[model samples]
Target: MPISNSSFAFLIISAFLFLSVFQTHGKVIINTNGIGQHSFADMKIDCGKECTRRCQLSSRQNLCRRACGTCCARCNCVPPGTSGNADVCPCYANMTTHGGRKKCP
Candidate 1:
């Protein structure tokens, strides 16, 4: 079967649109919630203190604080009382290390 130029262009455009939508699907799921409101409305963090405290047990203080800070900001929830309490925040707890271990400080 022979395809016309216009048909091929249409197919290309359709594929691009499909892929764009697929790539953004995850963001859409994360964004929508009750009343279309953000879940972190009252999110608060003492960045330096939280990071320092969370990373206290780690030998690599700088690395621990950096990664913990990122996870805290992204999850908008940090485990309470720190040190072996990551399970309190599912997202934080589920984060994986580069070597497939738990990464969140």
Candidate 2:
């Protein structure tokens, strides 16, 4: 049986639409724990704001601190007297110094 031109066009359009929807339905598996996933260290180097926000929302507070510290150290914001202080000291110093202080700048 000869296929009609309209039927052929319909088949092609249906196939294209199906493929487009299939692509849109793909699963995006994100590792919410941030372990064995995309490196925060790398992302922070390039995109500091996004990295900081993600770290702030992290379930593991220590991990978040570490991530923030890594970004700060890369950006040369890590303070003095910080001995492996990636977990607390830097952030504490920043908060205490600048939380509500009026800057002369």
Candidate 3:
């Protein structure tokens, strides 16, 4: 058996389509776990909800939530717990205030 011109073109086009989908979609699937240079940069999260949860343990809950929200908006990650889990999100962990204090809760 032999392949016809139309069939050959179909295979080539199918391969190209498969390759292009993976090439473009890889970025959308990868680097969304908050552990890369992109670091959840492509993810859409509710900062208000995450910040509220993050600030639950703070004595100054409102202030903590405000700062957490800022950090979450910038970094797109809110650590993992109410406090002291900044290692999980380096961007959130590393952000600093102008006054030389930690910015995120």
Candidate 4:
């Protein structure tokens, strides 16, 4: 038995449609976590003050300040007025370095 040209084209079209739907739809389904509810406009953050206060307790002042600054800017949050309160900002607290260490000071 031999396949006709129309039958071969139908199989190719079906495969292409199946792959396109799954690839695009899968990402939308996986990324629907509610993390995006907090918009930038709703964030009330003082980056400079937050970073300075958070880094003040560290012995590595310069490095601590740099890391704290980066985290504050991105997260728009610093834990509190002092160090060791990372629980206040879950996103900043959960960020990891390339080595799997905590990235923020």
Give me the overall lDDT of model 1: 0.72
Q: What is the alpha-carbon lDDT for the whole of candidate 2?
A: 0.45
Two-way TM-score contest, 1 vs 3, winner: 3
lDDT of 4 by residue, 4-83 (tens): 99999999999999988766544322112434423344435787777777778778878888888888787777877666
Top model number, TM-score: 3
Q: Give lDDT tens digits, candidate 3, residues 46-98.
A: 99998888888889998989888888887777878788877777888878899
CA RMSD for every model? 13.8, 15.0, 6.9, 13.4
Sort order, lDDT high to low: 3, 4, 1, 2
Each model's C-alpha lDDT? 0.72, 0.45, 0.78, 0.73
Q: Pick the candidate with the highest lDDT.
A: 3
Give TM-scores for every candidate, taking all chains together and pairing residue i with residue i: 0.54, 0.26, 0.64, 0.58
RMSD of 3: 6.9
* Cα error, candidate 3, residue 7 (Å): 29
lDDT (Cα, 0-100) at 58 in candidate 1: 81
